[model samples]
Target: MSSSNKIQKKTKSIDATKKLAEKIKKQALLKQKELQKSSNQDADADADNSTTHTALSKATSTSPVSSTVDPDAQLKFNTFAELKLVPDLLEAIQQLKYTKPTPIQSEAIPYALEGKDIIGLAVTGSGKTAAFAIPILQSLWHAQTPYFGLILAPTRELAFQIKETFDALGSTMGLRSVCIVGGMDMMDQARDLMRKPHIIVATPGRIMDHLEHTKGFNLKNMKYLVMDEADRLLDMDFGPVLDKILKVIPAKRTTYLFSATMTNKIEKLQRASLNNPVKVSVSTKYQTADNLIQSMMLVNDGYKNTILIHLLNEFMGKSTIVFTRTVAHAQRTALLARILGFNAVPLHGQLSQAQRLGSLNKFKSGTVNILVATDVAARGLDIPSVDLVINYDVPTDSKSYIHRVGRTARAGRSGKSISLITQYDLEMYLRIEQALDKKLPKEDKPAREILDALHIHVDKATAEAIRQTKEIHDKRGNGRRRKNYDDDREEK
Candidate 1:
């Protein structure tokens, strides 16, 4: 073989090896380019994800309104439709003339509808009742079971008011509710319970009484438990009673705790009763409604009554609630108003249940333009037409002041609260102002002519109120237990 032929074969082998290496190198470059492209795509996706997250965060946390606009005002909801409530509830809301959900309702209804426990902080008349009620009714309207929900309110009036709301909202669904409050007969309540009502609205004390004494009556099947005016309910020392009720009911249940303000007791109650709850607060700062006009008129203690009479004259023919510190004061004030030719009635714990209901009816029906009440009427009574709330006496605490003034300016209607502040009430007035986070407007005292004109009726009214109050006490005493002939004769 020639040396040139052998070299050529070796060169051919080397050429083949080079060609294979070039092909391999080209494949590797292509693969590298593909991997780089994939990495770039992933980086683009990460950037997109970051952009999405930031946009969502902005949407949820930031409002489009101007910086000068109220931040809380951005929480407004336009209609009940947006909350996805069922037709029945929407119909009831329409029939009740409620066009939109209040802030508390809008924030709370969804969580409640999702079957979550809730801690709602909103003032009265913010539609907290409907917030919980609509969900409870929606959940339980189809159930054949009895006593599906139990609501504990701080006062009997509030209990009744809650029951009324439930009945009104659930009217088309044939829902039945029993209000177990003290002023009513226990036997009657027991009878109502026998009917297996869907809801039980009761004050803690009366409910505890019925739960302990009533035979075969229990809330073992209660699917929901709601504490309305939760601060006052817990602050009133209903813990033991609430615990007993909780123990009796099913452990798996939804609980709603609503309050005008948060307190340590309410927090403890949350720990005890509510599961992991969504906190929906419309007003974190202690503040009244936007429409409430609160004012204070400084006057001498002796002139307080005269000023009240004049104010009543000024606002006559409009419904007013006069808050007094004592039952006797409420009675005296009402009697005085009545003697002044104003339609007035007295409401306090001391009044018989019949008397209390009568007074409330008169005030609500426009039969009487004025209701003189102690703190018993403060918390959750929903009288919508009250044009003014007169603090005939300064409230003992800021919460009381809030509740008393809350009687008017309800359901978004504008109203006024004029407090009669004497020199003795200066400290309390200041405390209320501090709690409100704003000072009340100062108003000029009534004119001399106004006082002088009303002064003519004061003496006659005072004497008649005193006599009628005595008669009321006598009637109550006589009704409670029969007095012996000798005792009656001695009293006479």
Candidate 2:
């Protein structure tokens, strides 16, 4: 209470804060070293090693990753099937052709099924879906009442993808599930709430919308609550919405919070959202398998599209995702790729739910080898055998770079993250590198060979005409719709 006491406490607190960050940094550095070391070994082995699996062989260069075995866990346990999965869920898993429990599933399911709140620290495509979904489904099977399960994802793509996971696992039991997110019919979601569905996978904003607008859409019976990508949801400032949902929903529900990185803010969010908790971590930060061959290239601002096109051609026939900064950028990149004769598609927030689903399905089915997406389209949507993740626009931050690269090299698969940096992108590139704690290798002309693969060689005059027309359109002539109103006004 005295100033002297407060000063001493403050000094101690600063010291403690430093210690915590250092602890996290040290743990992160250690894991990163492991991944880097493994990557070095894998890279030394083959240029075309599959990015998603551990069974690495030069012969299976075209195969999608089949499995990723955690070395640390192998010492303690061999497979996920060894874990005591409840009968019904195990049957469901078998039907889905899942032969083994992924690392997250193996680690998280037991404690979660025991009714322990969980903090799952794992990367995207690390099988975190099954980690939480299996336990929740198993719990649902035993409950007498049709209590709702609530899941909050950071993006519409992730929310919908989570719904798909639930749908797959719960289909046999007739457990109905719905995904609620922005850019969709909120009123329809409100109507669906009246149906008393067993699970609702949603983004924070729309879920909050339903809670605020719908009558008798009570979450008082919500028995399971999950916050996927907790850091991003919190970073995007969904805290108020998350809190409002918490305030209105039953406080006694079981909670699960997951994130790739455990920042201080994430810690506070967990404290706010979770009860007594169990922690399940597959790998510490940067502790991924050492098979990813990450690199970066620098280009001029005007030549960004040219560079991205070259990379796509160079890596042609490989399933890949390009992370663009905005929806417009995604569309531009997709258009350019298509114009140049690449089988590419755009995936972004502006698209309808049907389009989003269609794009991802096309990519997954390998009908389209290149998918361009905004950050919203990047998270939690798993498409197998993606060999490369190109940051057409280098991520504004490191977390995004991680999430972007994570789309590839999933499980034990070897993958690569290629960043295209221009002069304007220098600051952002440095920030990403700083956060990632590394520097990129500079390549002189990575684009020359890839450019040769591009088939769009139109004359300058033809391009000028199209560019002029586009410029005119961009100035808001045809894009705007004229609204006509009746001259007569009548009182209601």
Candidate 3:
């Protein structure tokens, strides 16, 4: 072709792309307006007009139900029984006391049951697991086959949580599911695979290991594939691994990809994985649940710990999660809390698999009311009773901030999140506010005498925590060195 012709063709292609982009933008705006109108109607009908105040001065609040319900299909069906679910599944849901479906479930379940690929966009704790699991289980009831579905999660805790949901929902149906993730016994997982369970919930890396090494454990016949927390999965650099998995799974399978936000990366993955998928998005942008009371405290760097202790004491007897940026900080904070006479536990990646699960169990069972954790516990682990979330360190990004605070105010429950902002965190905190499109209310500072009194106990606890942490590190180092020395001596 002539050079002029080539230039004309390129210009035409660019114009076409611009038109498509504009079309999508217009559609999104329409959806946003519709959702907003519906929310207003619901609020007018069922909202409580009372005000509640806590130790913190009057904080901003909204109706919890308004934030979670998507008017699409939700107004049509009010209960699980109205959704035309199978009798056995309906019985299980009723027994579990799940009366209503959240917006995600209300919208996605119908399309999923129709055997179409889906792209679900909702914040964390919006009942996404059941949205996908119900359709898969309903289909499995008709066709009982092993290795029928594969669910991938960004973290091990989320993968296990998804498996728990499957087990609970499918209890009456004799459904079999297995969770495969890193930091566990591969040989044991291999043995479980030998049993040929119906569903496999796993993190990307470990499942890839099994696919490569475990004989007779291929997803050749898998019918349903779910990528939960798809953005986080790719953010953790699982793109290449996911590409390989996609190539191996059958092309005709139903795929459901769920995420809190849609970046360029998520868009690309959606195109590559889902086939003509129906998109169901209940949230507009980076948004927290309306029931979540968010506030921040600007503190001096030296007084962050003292202020954190003060907040914890004020919220005593409430189930809480204290989020830190680093594993070391999480460990130290939990140690400090315990020393100060609070029942606390730490959850982070550095602990063994058993230890991590133990920490989660303790917090869930109310054996410990406070859990100090890194972002590992942020995304999709649902403990519905979580009443408070404390950001001991401001998250580096807005997305992490959304997930960290999402730990509370789940499933239409009222909860609170407080971010402890220091001088160094001001810039990042501002960025988070920009993303949320709203300013968080500044928490009233406690009396100076209150902090001064707590400082004495905090100082002693901090010193003791540092000493204990150092001793633990030394013991681990000595154990490693001793093993190496013994190996060398044996070789000699």
Q: Global lDDT of each model?
A: 0.81, 0.74, 0.86
lDDT per residue (tens digit) for residues 307-354 in model 1 = 888888888788999999987799888888877788888987776567
State the lDDT of candidate 3 residue by residue for 1-492, as single tens digits.
Answer: 999999999999999999999999999999999999999987865544432234223454322112234634435456888767778888899888988888888877878888988888887788999989999999999989999999999887888899999999999999999999877788999999999999999888788889999988899999999999888887776878899999999998999988877677877887788776888888866988988999999999898899999999999999999999987899899999999999999997767667889999999999999999999898989999999999999989999999999999999999999999999999999999999988999999899998999898898999999888777657768665465333222111
The parts of candidate 3 lying over 4 Å away from their true place are 1-74, 478-492
Q: What TM-score fits each model?
A: 0.80, 0.76, 0.83
Cα RMSD to native, each candidate?
13.8, 21.6, 19.6
Model 3's TM-score against the true structure: 0.83
Ordered from best to worst lDDT, the candidate numbers read: 3, 1, 2
Q: Best TM-score goes to which candidate? A: 3
User: Cα miss at 286, model 3 (Å)?
Assistant: 0.3
Candidate 2 residue 252 Cα shift, in angstroms, is 1.3
